[model samples]
Target: MTGDIFSENHEVEYYETNLLGNMTLSMLTDVIIMISQDQATALGVGTQYVIEHGVTWVVAQTDMDITRLPRVHEKVQVQTRGSSYTKYFAYREFWVRDMDGNELVHVGSLWVMMDIQSRKMVKLDEAMVIPYHCDRVRRIQRLNKIPKIHDEHDIMQTEYHVRFTDIDWNSHVNNAKYIGWMVDVLPYDFLASHVPTEVSIKYEDEVTYGDPVLSRGKFINTDNQIQTVHDISVNGSTKSIAEVKWKKLDKKGSK
Candidate 1:
């Protein structure tokens, strides 16, 4: 199992695209998680395997950098590898590329195993450790700590009720769903005019079914880039924080 880099091919489906006809950031994250699960299953440590052991993998943080997003019907390849692990954290790296072998996005994530009943982090076992074949070298810098959003800034907020579709087999809202919720709060005009270049998200707590979540966002403009910060909260308690950097695209649709 050592030295294995798992890969999968995908075609951007119509349903996965945004109004701009490009792949949505949330869907991209979903694809990354799907391919990672596929690889884990092949190595005998997937969702089912972990559930049987009363533990499941939970993402603590993720950072993604995008060069371009694929359009609907475009074929892409996703490759992922287990990069390393510590007493409580496991690191993973993912790359998405077009058929021409040009990279579309790069992602790095930190994960932890949690006991189902206790809902607390647990040390990874041999089953989880041996199959990953960790290299102990990071391909991307680890996710940076997202700063808390202060109230002094002009923050826009939206409320969303957790729907059934948002819940995964783990009986909680999927991590990627938070990204989608964050995107929904941005002004449509801004979304249509700019594309995200870098994204960082840190998960602090879990939002379960039937929970009402609030998404708050603030934007900062620099000469070359626009940065946005988002905080997702449940019952006034912050659950996750995310930051995105955007580069304005020319009218010709070039960055």
Candidate 2:
């Protein structure tokens, strides 16, 4: 709902930053997710509550727009809230800003309830979601969709085994780990020289602990923006897809 917010102040941890001393994309994602979870628990509908109800929350898609990334040792305010919801999807928004209140990042995501036992998507439960106080609309909100990678040649790939810590209480590799794997496959030079302006990612299947997942990515150059398409797979089956657009970082390290 409008103006409803769950906010927190955080000092960027050194371990979460990259070589440039700025928070990595995965860490940024984790920060936002943490706030959302905090909000849920505060409202008495957190992980344990949902698990007891035989369901778990799952993010189906995410769209992030970056203005600037908070650097190591920087203090920032992170806020999140339930924006709106439909019969099957709960839409949420998040923001990160410096102490001066300048926006560093904005993100939107779509989530659904999944039956824990069946691991299948389930319709949203009104009694459970009522705590968020978001409007329920008959029509689904429009979200930026990632295009299908149609026969995009043999792609550069990296395989990593899911570790014990990678799997969350939901018994699946956390979504942020998938994002990290996707970006990690890109060239170091590209990752270092540019910053993402737009990002779109969707989750299709979950990877469990000990599963070897392959992250494949290919760059697409254009006159205006450098773009990349990525897919995470397990045993040759696609589990997630992502597309990212980047702008070159200036000499001062700001886009």
Candidate 3:
């Protein structure tokens, strides 16, 4: 398979944002899911099509950055393009833009093809991928480096056990669940006051079912916003599965 470009339209809903009219991290994640679905549809291999063949695409890693919030009732064009494909992985990029062609967010993701029966990552088969070719192709830059948590001295403490429900078809903790965990550890008052302008998640290990994992978050305040880094560790291997840096909408001068 060569590659292809895919695009879709997004109409922001009232429920997708916080009380301050800013987008939530959950909503951002939703947009990424929709864009990826659209991309697969463009390639004739959307979700239902994959399910028909008993195959699925699992998101392995992602790094998304947001510059501004898309307002309610505003229209955004979600554009996606296939970046590259290795034996076991494929790279994709997505962007959200306004009608005037202003960029709002950038999202990069790594996807792996799997043997649904074996439930393991498998090499991409030519027959399964030959349809996504495009005359237009672009390269997605890979960030070999992962984002680091700046402050590790916070008194914040959280302990949670990973359940079987947390594991996806890929047999790893669903990437979205990490975001949920990060959100869960935050103070409810803080969540009520702030909106997420950006979110970045880096997956380093697979979280098994029934594993008792501990979550820790460090909050670092910037000039006008706050950055929170979360750590998910099991058996003393502390790898950051996700990091979020967001602006505080409740305070003066907050971005």
Task: Please list all clashing residue pairs in model 3, or write none if there are none.
Answer: 3-132, 3-133
Candidate 1 C-alpha lDDT tens digits along 162-234: 9999998778998889999997899988888788889999998999998999999988655776889999999
True lDDT of residue 103, candidate 2 = 89
| TM-score for each candidate, following the candidate numbering | 0.94, 0.95, 0.74
Model 1 spans > 4 angstroms off: 1-3, 136-141, 221-223, 252-255
- Residue pairs with clashing backbones, model 2: none
Worst ten in a row by lDDT for model 2: 246-255
Give candidate 1's TM-score. 0.94
Q: Each candidate: RMSD to true structure?
A: 2.3, 1.6, 4.4
Tell how far residue 55 is off in model 3, in angstroms.
3.5
Candidate 2 global lDDT: 0.86
TM-score of structure candidate 3:
0.74
